[model samples]
Target: MRIPANRMPTAAAYRPDSRDAGIRRYFGLVQFALIVGVPASRLCSWRHGTHIWVPSPDIQVGDHPGWSMACIDAWVPGGDPFLRPPVVQFADTAAIRARYHGMPASTLWACIGDGTIPRPVVWVDNRPGWLL
Candidate 1:
């Protein structure tokens, strides 16, 4: 399921639109936190150094892993991903992963880790670590 940012706070907040009770059984707070936390933290790397890591503001929601790209290039003026940290809105990534814990990691990784897709570049500003 593709949960757009406008519909949810983060990818973690999404739940599958399935009737299967098993699909709904595994969701929990901890899993949701990890799903949101991993990418959010990765995107925040600009505060420490030059692009330690950064995921796009958009994230794929569901049991399946999906890749993301930034809305704007980091080098463009006022386009830095670090400068614009994704908001911790309602039902974000933390919630989505929790809802779809049963999905296979292989599938998830395949969608998100595909080497063929082009990703936005994330530039780091190390002058002030943790400032952002």
Candidate 2:
């Protein structure tokens, strides 16, 4: 029997599709940095997650009321997939910029502009579905 190329295959098609078995595609590594900070005027409360970006070693944005912003930076891994994978961690703005080395100004900002991408299930350690 001849199969038409335009039609989508059902899961049962995989039973005889040996050509599809050998090739696997890797999406590559993704990293996210969760930043939390507090303003100098407000007492740091562990219950309320808040943080301000520190622009410099001496200048903490937390003190400036006009400058309250909390954010996360995600990094996409580049280079050999087998080697250097994407590195993700919870860190301050400065540390993230340092570790990824200008990734914020480059790839990171572009991604943020693209809009919210869904968080992967592996990252949702405390999500409601898992708690049950």
Candidate 3:
């Protein structure tokens, strides 16, 4: 039987029974980085620090092992922030320009780049697209 997407078990629920178990559920650094909204470099830094260490799984992927999503969830519990709708008012470059009455997009981007205006909370198609 096929399980519904929403009702499917989380990766943690499928933890292996033994150290030599053939099956494993884990998230690689890239996957974890995407989930956390930070760059992979930052995630690596966290791993290097004493506070965070990605959990090692019994089953390895290639030569490197990955962390169980369940453990990561326990370490940092929260829904994916990126998927959530913006909590504050936001506008795209065009909207922002219109709102500012002919302010150029380049100027707005420069301001955002230099931390003059708030940095974008969301990215759209590789472009900053939010206001705070």
- The model with the greatest lDDT is 3
lDDT of 2 at 7: 79
lDDT of 2 by residue, 4-59 (tens): 85673442332223563532211101111122222323322321333422221111
- What candidate 1 gets wrong by more than 4 Å, as runs, is 1-33, 36-43, 46-49, 59-132
TM-score, candidate number 3 = 0.33
Off by over 4 Å in 2: 1-89, 104-106, 112-132
Candidates in order, TM-scores: namely 0.17, 0.18, 0.33
lDDT per residue as tens, model 3, 1-132: 999978855543443446735433355665566555557787777666755554333233333335544545545523322222222333656666676677887898787789877765543223344542
- Give every collision pair in model 3: none
Estimate the Cα RMSD of every predicted model relative to the unseen true structure.
Answer: 17.9, 21.3, 17.5
| Residue 121, candidate 2: alpha-carbon lDDT | 18
What lDDT does the true structure give each of the candidates? Answer: 0.32, 0.26, 0.52
- Model 3 spans > 4 angstroms off: 1-23, 51-59, 77-132
RMSD of 1: 17.9
